[model samples]
Structures are given as C-alpha cells and as structure tokens.
Target: YVTPVKHEGVELNILPPGEDLEQIVEELWNTGRPGPEFRELLEKSGAYNFYDFIIIDSAPFFDVRYTVLSIYAATRYVVVLRPSIVDSRRTARMLRRLMKYAKDFGLSTPDYMARFLGVINLAKSGTIEADALLNLKFTGVKPSKGFNPFKHPSDERRKNLEKSIEGLRKVINFSNYVLPLNADISRLEFKEIIKGGKSDNDLKNTTENLLKDIWLHATCQK
Candidate 1:
C-alpha cells in the first residue's frame, strides 16, 4: 500500500485511517485475488503517467523498502557518486545491496553498470563557485554569458549561465531524451535570481538548464 505522491502537489495518505491490513488482505483474497484490479488502480490513478522522469530520492542509509521496489521496476537507475573515497565506498555498497535484492527476487541481471551516468565532483565548497566546479568536469546549471546584473538591471543572466547549461545539454544529447517539463520552467526562488532587477529570461533559462541536468543525470542508467 505504498502511496505515490506527486511533486508540487497534494500528499495523499497511502494507508487510510483505521484500516486493518490483515482484514484488507483477507477481503482482497476473498474477491478471488486482486492483482489485476490493483494494477488497474495503479494505472488509473495517473501514477503511471505522472511524469516521464520519476526520481526516487532514497535516504542516505537506504532503508526504504518501497524505493527499492520502484528501482527494480524502473527502466533506468541513476546513482550519484561524489568524487570522494567515502561516497564511492557507500555507492559500491548500495550497488551490492541492489544486486543482492535482484538475485533474491530472481530478476534479470542489469546490463552495463557503467551506463548509469556518473556525475563526478558535484556542488561547490568553500570559496569555490559553480564555474569552478564546472571547470573540474562537474556538470552544473549556470548562465552562458557575462552580464553584470548589478550594473545592468534590464540585462539577462543567460550569458552567465550558459556554460553549465551547455554541459547539461551535452549530457541530454548523449542520453537522447527531452525532459517532460516546459522550456521556461524555473525552480529557483525569485529572491535569489531577481536580485538587482534581472529579466525573467534569466530565470527561464536557469530553470530549463536545471531541469535538463536533473533528467539527464537521473535517467542516464541501465
């Protein structure tokens, strides 16, 4: 009875109040087994078509059972590994666990483990900025050109954010799949991007770049 919740939407309780699991199971069995009905319900609820790209964000320790089930059902699985010893070790352990689960379930073995895109050295640290991370081959989302937002209120931030966008675009081209979102989608807060009275185009470009990177990184696996 795992609930499928949509991002940026209402959260529905998976297990209803005062529901007895044993009674529900018995009732379902009384109806001559409910596998087909359950499958139809899953499809009819729009959970099947909610998004072209579904990201299952698991906890650091990876104890969630439903997430594991979803990963087995997914066509692609992306594992993000930081360029560090500790993160690499944790990722290896997680992959081992996933393989063990697949074997236990008698699922077919995955092909091409490296096909799952590995984004190395993500995020910035200390005085290092986004551009610095990009220079180190870390895929990021930033403007393309140089524009002093403080000096030019009407100027766009597209120039400044293009490099990261280009890097992400390359990855998307490699993956051969466009995102389900519109080109003008932005996930940033207005306060952060609109400082010094910047144009909306900046936000639009940033959003597009962000979405592209998210999809590319998330679905680049086998």
Candidate 2:
C-alpha cells in the first residue's frame, strides 16, 4: 500500500511498515504461491500511469522474493557502492545473486546488465581508494584470465571480489560514475556552500553536472 506523503512540499508515495502488512507477507511466504493482491491493487488503482518513475531499494542480501519482484518491475537499476574492500566483497555477492536471479527469470544478460548504473560513493584519497580503483580496472577480467589485484592465497573472497568488480565495470565506467567527492577542493567548496558562503555557484555547478550524468544514466530510454 503506497500512501501519499508530503515532504518539503513535494509529494511522495511511501509504503509504511506495520504488523498488518507483516501478517500478509508471512501468509504469502507460507503459501509458496504468487498472489494477485498486489497486482490488483496496482493495476486497479491506475497509479502506475500517474508516476514518471518508481524506484525500489532492496537489502544487501536481495532478500529473495521481494528482490525478484522489484527487479521484475524495474526499468533501470543503479548500484551504490562504497570504495573499500569489504563493500566490494559484499557488492560481489549481491550482484552475482541478482544476475543469477535475472537469468533464471529468462532475462538476457546484456539487456538486463545494460540497465544497471554504478556509483562509487564516499571515495577518499590514499591506499584505500587506490586499491578500489585497481579493483574497478580489472572488474570483468576473471582471475583465471590475468593478474588479479585481490588475489591472495589467504583471502578466500578474492575470486568473488574480482568477479564483482568486473560486473560493476561492465555496467558503469569509472570515468562517468566515480565522483571525486572526498577531495580537499571538493570538500572546501561544498563546505562553503553549506555555510552559505560565496561557493554557491560552485555547489550549483557541481551538483548540476553530477546530477545531469546520473539522471541521464538512470532515466534515459535505451
């Protein structure tokens, strides 16, 4: 059930969590069958035609049924990844599961994969970001094919990380999506904007440029 809620004068439809909804979910799971309840609600209301877009954010695990339903409904999917080893490892697991699920549903890998956009968040300087950049470079190149940055005899997650990075690179190129958000100049400019200083123009230009690319990638009809 999506209820309309207003935030800062903007209207947004939100699904409020409650026990009643939980009971329905549990019953749906126990029955092990797809039901018409949600479809009926969506189709009958005709609200789907009213909105320009609907975005679904899922858990790290992808959570099976709900994740499948969301992906089935999505026209485009954007993945937000933190620049770090642990986050890369987690992303590898999540993306592999998502791709497998998509394949099982008879979706073409190229078509399905094309709709994906990747964004690297909170990218900072030093060894951590450098290591992350290296991972991104060999993203789709398999460990068996060539030298892998993550390769280590003791690191059990090396293969998975390699594959995950590859999957991400296949979708989002580093030049487009990797924002230098944590750099000293960027931080100073943003701070000035936040403080209502002279960097207002800087902030506006920066955000507009960033959002232009992001919006184009996310909403552009392929």
Candidate 3:
C-alpha cells in the first residue's frame, strides 16, 4: 500500500556557507537581475503556488543585497523582533523606510499601511523589557514627535530615553498578535507536531489573529 504525499511545509534549496550567494550577485549584475526577481524566482520554483505564505529569512541589515531584494519581493511583511530597546528603535526606522519605498513605487497612503500585517507581541511575561514595551502599547496615544533616538549625541541619558520612546511608539502601532514568549516552539517534540497534542492557548490565538490579518489584507480570493 502506498501512502499519500502531504505538503508538509517549505522546501529550502539552501546554499552552503560559501560564495554561492556572491556568485548569484555577480550573475545578476551581468544579466540584470532586478530586486523583484527574487520574488519571481519564488513563483517560478512552484513553492509560491503550494504555500499560502512564504517567509523569507534574510540576513541582518548588514547585507544590502538580500535585504533590499527581500523587501522588494515581499507582498507583505510581518515584523518579529527581539525583546530589546535596540530592536525597537530599529523597528521604527525600518517601518518608515519601507513606507517611503512603497510610496516611491506609487502606493497611495491608504493602501500603503495595508502592506504590513502586524508585529508579533514578543513580550516575555514578568520581564522588565516586556513590561516597558507593554506600557507603550497600553499608555501612549502615539509616538511623541521628534522621537529619533540617535539625535542627541552629547547626552547619553537623553539618547537612551529617546530610544525607549521610539521603540514604544512603533510597538503601539503594530502590536496585534500576542505570542507568549514562554511558549518555546523551537524545542517542541515531533509527536507534538504530528498529533498537535500540546496546546498553548497564546500560540493558537496568535496563529488565528495572524491568519485573520492576512485575510483582511489579502487581495487573493481563496
């Protein structure tokens, strides 16, 4: 008896840690690989047809090639961030940059915000960082004007405060999916995956809310 094949998840045609990515960069330079061509590669691979969503984990902001290419290729974005002040500040800056790029590409203001789903609520329970960020979510009406963290160079204390305020402002705008930081999905057992036995209510709810956001923002009719 033959077992039926299932669409488990993604197929990662991963490049080894070498100059393969660099070679692609050179090839693209020669043959005019536009940034959106990354998305084209995805569609051509047949994976984009198979999966409802495709998450591209690119290198950090240091890698300009993968970073810009991924952003250009992505239809929408979800920001999963580390629970720290630095990440928060970067989030604010990054969102602004993405918006600028979209507008440059002819997206109107009303439709521009639609490109982002929401940020993951990665606040760890009882942690001070989580508490501080959560305060921004609950208390602030919006980010204070001129909340740029890197503005004040002379005063270290003021700079730190600016960073916190900026981070707070960004989270207030994007906090929708509540993923409890305690639920360590990385170490989940294989049986748990197959049977879906262990249930974390937070994770489940987060998954649902995320799907709801996708539905609300999606142009494709399913």
Estimated TM-score for each candidate: 0.40, 0.62, 0.59
Model 2, 105-175: lDDT tens digits are 46787666666676666554333353445555512111233434655423435445545566567654432
Tens digit of per-residue lDDT, candidate 1, span 5-105: 66547554353324574464356446662434434555677865864644445453544343354454454555554433455556556655555444433
Per-residue error for 217 in candidate 2, Å, reads: 2.9
Sliding window of 10 residues with minimal summed lDDT for model 3: 138-147
Best by TM-score: 2
TM-score of 2: 0.62
Candidate 2 residue 216 Cα shift, in angstroms, is 1.8
Error of 1 at 203 (Å): 11
All candidates in order of lDDT, best leading: 2, 3, 1
Could you tally the backbone clashes for each prediction? 9, 3, 0
RMSD versus native structure for model 2: 7.4
Per-residue error for 193 in candidate 1, Å, reads 5.4
Candidate 2 positional error at 172, Å: 5.7
Q: Please list the residue runs of candidate 2 whose C-alpha ends up more than 4 Å from where it truly belongs after superposition.
A: 1-10, 30-41, 62-64, 103-106, 130-167, 171-175, 179-206
Better of 1 and 2 by TM-score: 2
Residue pair clashes in candidate 3: none
Give the C-alpha miss distance for residue 8 in model 2, angstroms: 6.6
The TM-score measured for candidate 1 stands at 0.40
Clashing pairs in 2: 139-165, 139-166, 140-166
